[model samples]
Target: MAEQTPDSLTSSITSRSTTRRAVVGVGLGAVALATAACSTSAGQQEEKQSQSEVTPLVDTRVAFYGKRQAGIDTPAQAHAVFIALDLCEGTNTQALIRLMRVLTADAAKLCAGEPSLVDQEPELAAVAANLTVTFGFGEKIFDIAAPAAKPQWLKPLPAFDEIDRLEDAWNDGDLLLQLCANDRMTLAHAQRTLLKGARPFVTVRWVQDGFLRAHGSEKPGETPRNLFGQVDGTVNPRQEDGTIDRYVWGENVEGLTPWVPGGTSLVIRRIHMNLDTWDLSDRPAREDAVGRKLSNGAPLTGEHEHDKADLEAVNELGFEVIAPYAHIRRAAPEKDIERILRRPYNYDLPVAAASGISQHGDTAGGISQSGLIFCSYQVDPLAQFVPIQRRLATLDMLNTWTVPIGSAVFALPPGCAPGQYIGQQLFEG
Candidate 1:
């Protein structure tokens, strides 16, 4: 990729060739630091200062070494790429350990706005944009590494025959890499670098790219809207309220995991939204389907997004304000323990005909195939996630417009300190 030259600096430099060399040099730490007492021109000092200062957008960093893995509790970035890979045949515990070390080291550097040790495009590494790379392990990984340490709930979700049209292309894998960033370039670079590092031990199984509102486009704390135009994640647990701590982090929950305190389970469902049929439905029908106001995502009987949903409230004709089969009603947790942290992203890709690459059965005679990459994190999938999914699968009206085409469950290990690699406990514990 070509380096972007600043217009201000471009005019000051003489020839294009010289300007490129100068810009490259400036980017490569050629800035001259002059004290106030030093004899340096004011313009040169200003230029030096401008080159040194990085915008917060690009400079933001999420620590790669932590108690818990990032990209889970961290605020959602504008873009994400979920990569699932299967371990190469004959990859044993020691080989897996080596693979984790390599990938973890790469993640540490990339998340800190540095390049991989073997980075060919080091220039792209500077724009971290709050990049985070999180690792997950599938059941196959444990079978190879430490079968005894595998959690009982670390397997594929129970078959939801009625609502799921499962496709192998997006299904199971031995490992998972979830990379997110506010900048697509940073996210892409991190993905490439990590995948390159892991090529020796694993082969790519599937890649799902997703996005939401770009950075700075929406106000902080505002919930993101899905492709369906409904405000998503309104019912998510908040870190300040201890919901995230109790549910997502599994503070007091028993049967939490073979990996806990700093570990969680991730459920990825690639739900394809039938925009063609959804567009045909009327406003009231749409609102009734989701049991939330289209304008603000409030419950049918409430005025604000966060207002308690009046499930029993009635209409003028004596009908329940929130329908029994409405999505919000069905998706609501029956018990406090049933809650999970949802962090979904929207994906709209060109149709097979347009892109000349067919994926699953996405040739809907439209210009694009759009859907939500439904991601949820919890301590235990069977206890916390499955119950809610069962309710939705049986009788959520939104099911008419959405079909889950892909599903995978992964065990996310705790973050590691310096000199340690992710999932180290799983192999060593």
Candidate 2:
């Protein structure tokens, strides 16, 4: 080659560099396309596998006709709606009987995955999802239909000035219907069907909707955590051990209400949780308030969730491991008869702008309203549920973060056979 000028030499070098970069860019572009194709294929395959593995929760069913209603002792479903209705003017004994008969038949049909006779949306009832419909009678119900069957315990809970900030809108009702299911669609359908069927005989007083962890999210028999991140309903009576029969069902038990054989009482309290203040507290302080570890809900002195809390256990500084004012300690039943079967559900909703008040009456302004629908079932509310509640209301560190805003008590009659209605025993006995 001839001796090249400086400009020629520079041009030759630049051309070679450009050609090399072009080749590299083409190679990189091909590799990127291949990688993207592989990623897309893998993602599609994973999604398809996931879709195939999911089991639809539609076919499962719980029996509707039995000695006791299904929802009280049945496993707590993921969704629930507690509806309170008042008897319409001029609703008499005959009308009450007719209402119960109609409601019972509708409930039986819904629980069996069939629509109610007046169901407007029959397709929604196709999924059973373990639907259960439980009926309860308020004091007025007994006053109108069966005065002699009225249990003394069927009244509003005693005032707890220390913790209760009762609201009239949620206080009491003449009739109560508890609808629970693993699916929200099923629950909503059941609620609508029941309410529509009874609309002619009653007027809606209030409706409280609540929920727990989705079905199958936790293993069977696992205790659920509340909004405050504490395990709730840990110390409930076990059905398999006959505690339910003795404490809840009260079958042939002496000294208990005669009207409660195979029947029970229900107390529903709307407890608002102040999560804004609770979130400010430290983890140790939170656990101390609840008297259990946040990790697994074990008592401070124990390691397992069900471990009996050593109420007398102390630490190095001679302080109680579980504080004297702790929630679990205050809520513990002093007598075995004081125990009640608790089935609670958490509720959360976007705070309404008009009120600006949180569920706990915290007007400091919050983004959400949240609370627990505290439900307890027993043979007698006065004997079993009230005593423990009084203890908690007297002194519970949790009082700083929780407040009861609504309360009601109802007598839950025993279940009836296929041909009988829910409250037939009480009315016709």
Measured against the true structure, the TM-scores of the candidates, in listed sequence, are: 0.85, 0.86
Off by over 4 Å in 2: 1-55, 252-255, 354-364
Q: Per-residue alpha-carbon lDDT of model 1 for 11-120, expressed as tens digits?
A: 22224334444554564453345454452454465456544542345646777888888888777878999999999888899998899999999999998788889999
**Which structure among the candidates has the greatest TM-score?**
2
Screening candidate 1 with a backbone cut-off below 3 angstroms (N, C-alpha, C), the clashing residue pairs are none
lDDT of 2 by residue, 301-378 (tens): 899998999999999999999999998989888876888899999998776573433443472366657789999998
Q: What is the C-alpha RMSD of each candidate to the true structure, in Å?
A: 11.4, 17.6
Q: What Cα-based lDDT does every candidate model obtain?
A: 0.82, 0.82
The weakest ten consecutive residues by lDDT in model 1 span 1-10
